[model samples]
Target: MDDPIMKHNVPDTEWFDRSSLRRMLRTYSLVYIKPDVGRKGNGIIRVKRLRAEEFEISYKQTTSLRSRDKVYSAIKELLNPDKEYIIQQGIDLATYRHRPFDVRVVLQKPLGKWRTTLMCAKLAPRRSSVVTNVSKGAKDYNLYRLLKGTDQRLNRSEIIRNLIDVSKQIAQILGSHFPLKILGLDMGIDKRGNIWFIEANTKPDCQGLKKIDRRLYRKYLRAKKIMRNG
Candidate 1:
């Protein structure tokens, strides 16, 4: 329930009543509507801001709407009164060559101490989508290739430090909450060099591990074994 990435010193998001949400949507520039208990990147929507005179809406299910009233009505009609949901602020992610991308950081607690096992870059599909979850058709790029590739503003040291620091911080926070032996964190690094907590997965994909730094992985394994045997 605690998301340090939410910022604003606000408490964890709570379920808003129907009228309250409408009022909030009118006030907040952007908001996300997601299932409170959903998993595997399902049932989430990034609602765009509505101008005083113009309003538009789009989703995976319905991509086209002509009028503001229609958009509002459609959103309201899709709401599930029986289910719990959260309204979150939308984050404008950093882009790579005009295409938005996010970083997928894999963390494992093998023995006891938390360690980051792998890091991968996920490029969102050309279509407009807020999340870069693979299930949502986001393409996975080689992490090292992207990092090592030419970008005048970014240096290798900065890239590594940013990812490493954020990964460790997120692992520390989640570990404090659940005391899990292993966990995977999917994080977002924005254009302004801000780190965001997208979501955490109990079972993370290890496919990208083979492509990441071997030395780091070895250290994690060695530390995990020591803790397990201790």
Candidate 2:
């Protein structure tokens, strides 16, 4: 949100509250609320404004339609009141076999220069999942094949190149502010092939890369070794 150059790729995001909620819902038809320090897609809430005075909120497997006045209460019921949350505009994620997915870009700064070492994706196991989180039962897919094979109409090559460029730029920009050696960025692409910034992970969990692609997984391990030695 701070960088002007990369901010444009980010979805509308703000602190989660009654005011921000009402204001954001008024501006955008869809919004998602997530824990500030959450992981594996837990404690996330999806809210959609169907029409005036009618709202829909979905969490995990349960979904409910609430009136305009009761929307907040419904969302609050699913939240752990102790934790802080962020409300963000939801993206119409590209789907594969009816399941939505998101891209994961691994950038490592070995001996000072930043480079994207690995690119993969996590596909949600079911259509109802609020997130495409691997730890929470999502399946890993080869980013290249997933983008190229399924979306026949899109320019997959261009999207891949753009993802690399945008991800590297984000790494460089964020690296300047934090003393981080590795970053796992969660990136999103809509059906129209436009890329969006989701989140940046300082301690990215890329442990099981072998399942997606053996070669890229080996490269990821090598990058980790180099970053560790330095």
| Cα error, candidate 2, residue 193 (Å) | 0.8
Question: What TM-score does each of the candidates earn?
Answer: 0.76, 0.95
Worst 10 residues of 1 by lDDT: 5-14
Q: How close is candidate 2 to the true structure, as a TM-score?
A: 0.95
Scored by lDDT, model 2 comes in at 0.88
Evaluated against the true structure, the overall lDDT of model 1 is: 0.65
Q: Top model by TM-score, which number?
A: 2
- Residue 160 in model 1: lDDT: 63
* Local accuracy of candidate 1 as per-residue lDDT tens digits, 129-229: 75677777887776667655533245656766777776777777768878676667766665665667666777776555554666656765675577578
How far is 96's C-alpha from truth in model 2 (Å)? Answer: 1.1
Where model 2 places Cα greater than 4 Å from the true spot, the runs are none
